[model samples]
Target: MTNVLVLGANGKIAKLATAQLLANPDNHLTLFLRNSKRLANAASDRVKVVEGDAASEADLKAVMADADIVYANLAGSIEAEAKAVVAAMDASGLKRLIWISTLGIYDEVPGNFGKWNHQMLDGGYLETYGAAAKTIEDSDLDYTIIRPAWLSNNDEVAYETTQKGEAFKGTEVSRKSIAALVAKLVADPSQAIHESLGVNKPNTDGDKPAWY
Candidate 1:
């Protein structure tokens, strides 16, 4: 079985992804988190949890050892943490990385929408995300980056996917949908290798679908 290490394990999206991963039989997943308290119910006989900051080399090394794939579904100072993760991955000889990024990484949305999103995240944050993405893109290992449109709390999964360089159409998309997509990426690595895209419901009406 392929062993997977999911960084940012305590987050909401990570929780959904973790549940999906647990349901699968061919893989074993380890949840690496900074705080285990927030992840109380996110456990099972097949699921393992490791506590540590993703930015620390020692913690990363402990978790990265024997890990076949890394899923980086994180928030907060993710850029710096991503750098640390890359370093640790390199040290451990682990290659595959799947990062959940935000929309507008390529300035796909324009005018107030893009401006608002960028402004809210700050220019420095934008640069950081970009730099982090570029780092993985330029690295020798295989990588997949997924950027979802305005995340929602809906409990549904939709097969909406957008091509790179296209504007993110939907006004909102479910966080669970994004998490489900992340789970899919973890299961099948070859679908969108070395590319980033936006996800949203397919309906013309701007509404986020609930994740089932």
Candidate 2:
């Protein structure tokens, strides 16, 4: 049985991912969140809840103890928190990491959509996420960076995943799909290890629903 620690465990998609993780009889899941109260009643023998800020070194170290893999789902200031997570993982000697990032951090979103993403959500903050990704990528640890296009609340499972160069195509994808992707990463990370992968819902017209 693999013990997996999930950071940002209370987010919408994270919650779904948590469900999938819990469904796995062979996995021990830990839900690390700043406010455990926000999490609906989803805890059991296989699922444990730990309350603490992911950015706090002590808390991260404490929660990461004895874990085989760590799946990061924390949102907001992700770059900084990612750095902290790297440090904590390094300290704990847990070399497996599956991180979630934005699709266009590489500036590869394409055409007007890319321009708008850069103008609106991209901003200068992306440098931080990129740097954070670089830190994990360069480390001796095995890491898989999963970047998602746009997030939505739709309940669907059909979606596509790409490597570094492939375009994300769609404007938005369901959070549930992203969650399923995370669960897959947790299950079979070796295939994507030490690689960066992109994900999105393949669209017919190429023009998709606004992520906003």
State which candidate has the highest lDDT: 2
Q: lDDT of candidate 1 vs native?
A: 0.78
Per-candidate TM equals: 0.88, 0.91
**Per-residue lDDT of model 2, residues 122-152, tens digit only:** 5566677777777777777788888887778
Regions more than 4 Å wrong, model 1: 204-212
Summed backbone clashes in each candidate are 6, 0
The true-structure Cα RMSD of candidate 2 reads: 1.9
- lDDT agreement with native, every candidate: 0.78, 0.80
lDDT of 1 at 200: 66
Least accurate stretch of 10 residues (summed lDDT) in model 1? 203-212
**Tens-digit lDDT string for candidate 1 (1-212):** 77889999988888888888777898798898988766756666667877889878778988888798999987677777878888888999988888888777777765566666776766676677777777777777678888777777778887487777777766567888888887787788776877777776666333222321
